[model samples]
Target: MESENVDMNIIPPQIAGGAMDAVEKRFFETEAEAKTFFENTSKRLLSVNEWGKYAGMSSFQLMDAHGIRADRTAEPGDFIRIDIPGPGTHAGMGYDWVRVKEIKELSNHEEQISYIIVQPCSHPMDKDGAIAHFFKDDATSTFIIRKFGLVVSAEEHGRNEIPNTDHGKFLDKSRNFVVGMAAKVGLSYPQWKNLVKGLLQN
Candidate 1:
């Protein structure tokens, strides 16, 4: 979980993309092999349990060298990753990351595995950026978890300060709610183009 040194200073000014672009760029052994691996594995990364509290238990890069609990058990220097699941009916749900502080697993194989834990967030967009949430329904609720598979170390917000309740007030019907936040940070891109386009129309 080598993540604390992450420089939050720079923001990539591009729209976050979905569809697991193994096609556009080949990072694996071969294009077809990449596609197959991506198709099989990528969905598992984005998809979460019905409770949304934890990710599905299969695609861990590492085994048990580390554990990610909901309570901010991770330290600032630890690494974190998230699989951007989807955009709402209208937009994409971006991925998020957090840090890990302590871990019992020391083996190289175990350390590479990503930790997961689900807490509660009005928006599930990852720390990287926010995605468009274009649901017509304003009554629905979704959770944007910070550290998907981590431990809940303390009373949570108080002792660890893992962002327990930032967008929470706008939980139900959080469509415009989370999108608005992205606009302020300069992190929004193609995903955040809807309202901006409308503004330009006039």
Candidate 2:
């Protein structure tokens, strides 16, 4: 079997610089098995809600997540709704929303790669509402699945930007401060790591 590197050019600099980065990989005995697993795993990666099942085994679980497709096609305009349990929920701040910015696929005789990239965005239901988004638009989360020879890898790559809003100039300093502090203290890495593990689980 031939060995080749998964393309890293798909990752933008902003996401590459993200504060939280996590990755996980699984190896298969045969390239055919790896290809089969890649197809199933890619679907799971795109179905954001199913993440809970895989991450549930970890102490830090992804409690709630949903994907809102723009159309039946499941393209770039879709949205992901994520609820992070904490003060934000207690205060009725609402869930975090990220827009699907890109869905890319690349392939050759020896390899196949697929990824979805999302960036923080205003809540789709209430764009002008008072709900404070936890991350700035500059922040991104990329979910990737790559098949190379007899190995498969799943990756989550993105940067966390300070919390801000796209709807208005009103900034929630208190909430942003808390989230910023959490990001700095490395509160999100474990969750992301578990999420990546969930992606590669058998």
Candidate 3:
């Protein structure tokens, strides 16, 4: 199929009964554009393009079938990175996931930003069986919200991974996104509770 931005027109079931005003998560690649969008968030919601990615697969399963083997493989500290097939239900529309190794608070442009260096488990198992490691520690694959097969004994599974491939930006911008959106509109985003009480129409 010809790849293009997912048309917001195709509404997901979650919004079938008006459960959500919209499920579109705007992402921008650059901070300036993201900020500009936020400045006028109230006028209309425009998703910023943070990053462009694809598992280079037809769908999530294509990547899995090619070379995805996270089953029982690494530890919390053991370095690991694998392309897990996104269920494509939520977590925005994207094709790739970032496997974070560790997070550090560093100063950039005099601003404190949380940065992570992850081994892109894209198929780089070293002699020691590590995808990518720029750190001193060998145990990485298991930490954070990474997806691991049964080999590592990770959580059942996660809907979203930390440091999303297209997750984009640092903490400052992230916090700003929330605060900015709120400032744009007098109301805050809907709370997750709606799903529990069935308050959401859908």
Candidate 4:
């Protein structure tokens, strides 16, 4: 009688959080493939688990060497959702939308993959520049946000950092949110118009 050994480290699909029905069904063999898909279709990259369910494959089959299956993909003219930190004194926050100027992925010093999602912001003379988020591959959960408005604002404000809880203050000193999301699922901004364009071409 031979005993079957199982690896406990492997996360099963059943525990990978149920299938993501809100996202469209798409599959890519590699990161480059995924990036190309976004460029052509203007679609956000789905998580490895989401892609697995959609493609009827396993997570192991979908993830890259870095365990990154996909990321939030956007092109210029896209309105990405960001919660701008307001003045700490008044606790007033700004739930705003900014246009995406550029989106690209790069590797960090530790060889971890990160996406540099950049959006130009005008915050008066000294603060005028792009607000970029260096979202690491492993920080998926902390990086993207689905819901917007008061609920998210409250959660962010209550985080560890006390005193100046405003995100803008941090950005002024070279800091920003782990990542900002436009929507929970799929691409953000100019949604309907882009959908129509894709459909007409197909």
Candidate 5:
């Protein structure tokens, strides 16, 4: 591929209201090596079901995260089904859902960047399901993978328009409260940190 100057800022800022960001990168001995690794990393990043494997390797057992695609491809409207612990283990209260809003890519020869942006959404199966949404609709989780020269980086940026709003039943609302507090206290950082590390891993 022929390399070109890509303006990464065009991806738009995912941060809003209260937010958190986690980034991890790995350097290769040569651009050839980075390109090879970038290809493998991209596959894992898009295979949402594999998220639990990375999260399990982290210090905290954040949740058994899983991605359920609405169609054959991982395009917009896909749903990410997360199996949280505690109350989340229950039938109606065990999951949170987010919808894939965008999947973008920009590449030339020496540089490549891909983005997967998701926002909190109502349950796909049941609009009024008892399940809770961890973040508000304005909240978004943007996952990025960039390969530039001999270096490759993975990033997770979360933006929450309102970190304190309640969006579901009492249990769902309580879950949201706990998640909001967790983000505020920095407990959610490790989960993202490990996730990005997993993406960059050889």
Candidate 6:
């Protein structure tokens, strides 16, 4: 399919419905611009799963189809990022890392796995400081609003690049596209930078 052209300068109506308004004030000159961008983005048919691939998890579904379990997938201390309260709401649209504290198999649901997670209260305002329980299937699948996946790092930037391929240019374009959509929803470029800095530091 041909990619839809979007105007990054306009904000969509959806921004007013979320936590993005907080940061939108800092980056966008006016709310109207943010609205225009978001309205255009809404016309695009990108699903949450396709968008989540950029955050990592490009091959999770394939791996799952082959019957791989969490024991062979993720390990403790590995950062698993998830979106709480999901999309199309006033909830914040940010991926917060919850490190795996423990991994256990479910007796009730065969082959299903769960992870005990500890969210780092890196910031003073973080209220989800307590350990939380997350299911591996819930985290990987995007049949619902929330999708948890592996965290992509700057270190893995060119690991999949083919020799002589202009992968960096394509990656930059992809990054800019997502950033544009994120900014419309209130995760301005500055806020995203801050969020990534926190992720890398922690």
Q: Top lDDT: which candidate number?
A: 5
After TM-score superposition, the amount by which residue 42's alpha carbon in candidate 5 deviates from its true location, in angstroms, is 1.0
Give lDDT tens digits, candidate 1, residues 4-105.
334321211223311110001113445455334433332233332221232232111111114233323333233334333333322223323333232221
In model 6, which regions exceed 4 Å deviation? 1-51, 54-72, 81-95, 108-118, 121-202
Q: If ranked by TM-score, best first, what sequence of candidates would result?
A: 5, 2, 4, 1, 6, 3
| lDDT string, candidate 5, 1-202, tens digits | 2237756653446556677889898989986888888888877777777676786532211122243343233656667777655455122336666677887787875579888888766666565553345567777788889888888899988775454344455655666777767776778788788889887776
The TM-score, computed over Cα atoms with residue i paired to residue i, of candidate 3 is: 0.19
Residue 151, candidate 5: C-alpha displacement in angstroms: 0.7
Write candidate 4's Cα lDDT for 1-202 as tens digits: 1113422111112222111111122444565654444343322232222222222211211222232222433343344333333311111123222333333332222211122222323221223332322221112121111111111100000011111213445543233232222222322223322322332121
Supply the TM-score for candidate 4. 0.21
**Candidates 2 and 3, the one with greater lDDT:** 2
The per-residue C-alpha lDDT of model 1 at residue 192 equals 20
Model 6, span 56-157: residue lDDT tens: 321111112122223234444444334432321111113323343433322221111122222221112233331121111112111101101211121110
Q: Kindly list the per-residue Cα lDDT of model 3 for residues 1-202, writing each as its tens digit.
A: 1123422121112211111121222445666654444334311111101111211222211122233443332222232332222222122122222343433322223222222233334232222332221111221221111111211110111111222222223432343344324422423122212111121111
- Candidate 5's TM-score reads 0.80
In model 4, the clashing pairs are 146-184
Please, what are the lDDT tens digits per residue for candidate 2 over residues 1-202? 2225645467766632236668888989987899899998887777665765665532211212243333233357776656665544212245566677888777766778888888766556555454435666677778789888888888877665655533343345466556756765677777777877888877
In model 5, which residue pairs have backbone atoms overlapping below 3 Å? 2-109, 3-109, 88-94
What is the alpha-carbon lDDT for the whole of candidate 5?
A: 0.67
Q: What is the overall TM-score of model 6 with all chains considered together?
A: 0.19
Listed in order, each prediction's TM-score against the native is: 0.20, 0.76, 0.19, 0.21, 0.80, 0.19
Off by over 4 Å in 1: 1-76, 88-93, 105-202
The residue pairs found clashing in candidate 2 are 18-159
TM-score of model number 1: 0.20
In angstroms, give how far residue 55 of model 2 lies from its true place.
3.3
Name the best candidate (by TM-score).
5
